[model samples]
Target: MSKRKKAPSGNPANRGLSFVDRRIARDFERWLAASDTPLSDPHNAAGAVGHLFDITKRSGLDILEPSDTADIADMLLDIGPNATGMVDLFHDYVHFRLETSRDPRWHQAHDELEDVLDDDTGISAMLEAIITDAETRDPAVIADALAHTKVIDGVTKLLDWISTSRPITDTGALRLSDIEPAAAALGLRAAGARTLPATGDLHGQTAIADGITYVQSMWHLEPLAAWWRALLDTDVLELTASRVRPGRASQRWRTEPTPPLDVASEVVALVVSDTVLGDLPRPLRLGCFTLPGARHTCARGPHPRRRRQARTPHRDRRTIRPPCRTRLADARRSRPGRTDPQPPRHPIRRSRGLARRLCYRPARGPR
Candidate 1:
């Protein structure tokens, strides 16, 4: 994970939760910028007074955190006809423009995504499709993918340990001697070979390949223990009480080296993602961005309204270490009443996870 560059602009304590705040704040701005709603118009100014106040109240509500899938769906549905548009802006801002500045590291994983945002004006359709699926998606899908990832992680470690000792018994089954150390690696508990029941409901479900049973490892027992049992139940090891290595997928997984945590997380997310969702490869990736707490100019921390109001191009003010740009826009040409040339009104139609894409302007010479 990227280290917090300069201590997030929010409370140090609040940094943990600031990912949601920062994401919501920027989402709100991007939505307003891309929508048909003309924030720059004088007539809309009459309504802006009430919506801005509502934005303040809503932001104070910790962004109306949804408890379940239904709550999010309701919030988004209401935004469509509520007429004020603040609810919609705040409620669903997944379609957003990417900032001009980005860390080089993220480019490796998201290079194609960045290209899509920068060049694909059609991204708005994709963004809408994502939202449709996201509303129906379990908000905790990321957590679920991580849980699966742990299994992959724990199992890989256990298998490596097994290879060194070859803990196989005379009967050709392996023993669980010294298994606790493997379990400890994953922060999970292991048994003394006789702790768990000899057979689970799928006692005979082992996959026998070339006379060697290859048991399938599905969701069970944290991550490590379930995998340990896969080996034991398949007779790779003597089926003892405590088993289940977290990372290994099945008997075949042993033949191949385990993927890096990032790769593993992405693969697992894809396995769980629906086509409509486009892709689920990056809860861990997004976490990588937010977990470190994105840096912004305001040291007191980022507020959605404050985030929205800061429209000027900050130049070098909040250039995050490793290059995470905090400025939502390069507002030099975006400020009102300036008769300078402007990019398309809604240059890059995007939002929330849709962060990426700004006006593709030519390189400028230093003024």
Candidate 2:
């Protein structure tokens, strides 16, 4: 096959075109100027708002940020309110504008207000129209839309105001009434306020205590242990508890590697014996109790006594016999050294004997 050729890499003949077609850019600049005037006109405000909304949406730029808001506001000013019909359109636009200002970014709000107020008509009429519209629109839809339009400047100003009051412990405690005007000025709705705790009320304390008790309950223990086991087995968590800090309790615990097989087996046995068996009533305990078997003659399909007999291990054991006479032979040979080489010792037998003697094993020699 023929080799493919690489394209030229240096600046091309169309470099300027690549940078944003100067003519189209200028056209957009002019349109922006024209939009300000049209936006002020009641008849033209909707279309301008729609266009600005679309532009900002498509740009993926946050219009709430100071830099973006300032840039957009400057562009709007350049377009000038005179170009659009009715100076009132500008007022409407300003009144419906959402607060996009964030903390410490007063520049955008200052610049935008300055630019708009500089116009002879001012923005009050637009505000009145917006307030009227808000009264008529669905509150839920308005709330959602207002949430999206939050201006950083409005939030910052409200926070600052709340800070001065000392009545609110935190900005989070401020009510809608406290910030509604700021929100309105930014063309947004104020959300409802939350109630504060009354003095001497211990609701938060009670909740914490209840949560701790719920966490400590035995029913939650196994699940919690399993969760911790899974975490450790996955190698994301270390077994050492020292790594955790008091204030960082909210941090997720990491997973560790799977535990040794013997440990897992022991855990399973403990869960079955200590947890399950210990939970049963004494008379119904496994291996110690006999349960009934099915009795076809009974209306309930089984007599309790028969069912108990079926479950009883002693009854089952009576029906089975040892595989060979090895045990008898071992018993005979075990009596005083008959010395016909004793039948090979079973590993299980050796294990049982070793286990019985384990308590007597000597301590290891000093290292």
Candidate 3:
């Protein structure tokens, strides 16, 4: 699939000298002044802000208030209802302004003052949407969520390993197994660890290397771009990208200091979020809720929506949590393992459920 669709915003340089427009232009100038993308580039913030501003002017409103995110429904009605490239330009510009611009005036190429979205929901919703989109599995949405969990495991394991030790390969190239399967490998993390990079190659994920199923598997089973974007958002991870793979120009991620708590999100990719997940398959958003531990005994229960809870309640809090370290020898050595069998690992981040599943191990990251 094409990674993302970006629209062209009209000429920000052509904005009027009216007080509201000038204030917006000034904000765009300051925001663009600090941007990494040069002003000359069409993709840059200042270059495209004016395109949609013109649309707002045509609407007779000081600002452009989009009725829908994926498709600017209101704008399309004003023009024609066709999904033209020009419409795409407007859509892309909205997200571009929202993500790249520093101020709200520049966010939608408009003049009306509106507060930015609730930070927590905006961040978490974007995350869930991406992971759901990234999934390409045949089984169900749960499979995709499971695979994302594995990626988190892989990342956490790699961070713990590389920071405390040196790279296994002399040239600083870490293998795939080193990073994936991080949850299961915790027992072996101190003993034998696999340090794989974020791979763009799907075939390589399951292709055997060094006698393990790519150490931890399933991350590459989804769209490679999503996997790359998912973990890159956290500020804790400082990935030094390497191109050391034999055939592919894949990333060779190495360890940074163990991530400290409290990094929210990043916008490296122009993600196809900010829209309601109505564009995606229903299974991705609506899911089954089974008994926490009893897979064999229990039948698939009604999902969160069926229970009449608020929609997408999980996204309400987008907090970043650091991985907690367990000192088994000092604290739990005297205690014995429980006689009851351990429960299955929860795929997505259900902290309490995952705790029961990954009993006595580190938690999955800021899910």
Model 2 lDDT per residue over 1-367, tens place: 9989988652232232323333322333344455555333443433443445434333333333333443333233323333233223323333333232135544434444454334324323543354356447664553344334222123223323323232211211222343344334344333223332243222221112212211111112232222222222223223222231111111211121222222222222222222222212111211211001000011122112111221223322111212122224444343221225322211110111111111122212111
Candidates' C-alpha lDDT: 0.32, 0.29, 0.31
lDDT of 3: 0.31
Instruction: Provide the lowest-lDDT 10-residue window in model 1.
Output: 290-299
Show where candidate 2 strays beyond 4 Å. Answer: 1-46, 56-61, 80-112, 115-367
lDDT of 3 by residue, 193-311 (tens): 34443442223333333333332222322222233333333332333444222111112223223222212111111111101111111122112111122221122222221211322
- Give the TM-score (vs. native) of candidate 3: 0.22
Superposed on all Cα atoms, the candidates' RMSDs to the truth, in angstroms, are 22.8, 39.1, 20.7
Ranked candidates (lDDT, high to low):
1, 3, 2
**Cα distance off (Å), candidate 3, residue 162:** 2.6
Best by lDDT: 1
Q: Write the per-residue lDDT of candidate 1 for residues 1-367, one digit (tens) a residue.
A: 8876774453232234445554544444554555566553433433442343333333222222221112222222222234336433332232222332243322222332233223325444654454356446553564344445554455456556755344433322234455346555455544333333334422332222332222222211223333342234233333223332323334545554433333333333322221111111122122222110111111112212112222224322111111011122233112111112211121111122222211111111111
Residue-level error in angstroms, candidate 1, position 281: 13
User: Order of all candidates by TM-score, from best down to worst?
Assistant: 3, 1, 2
**Which candidate number would show the highest TM-score if scored against the true structure?**
3
Candidate no. 1 TM-score: 0.21
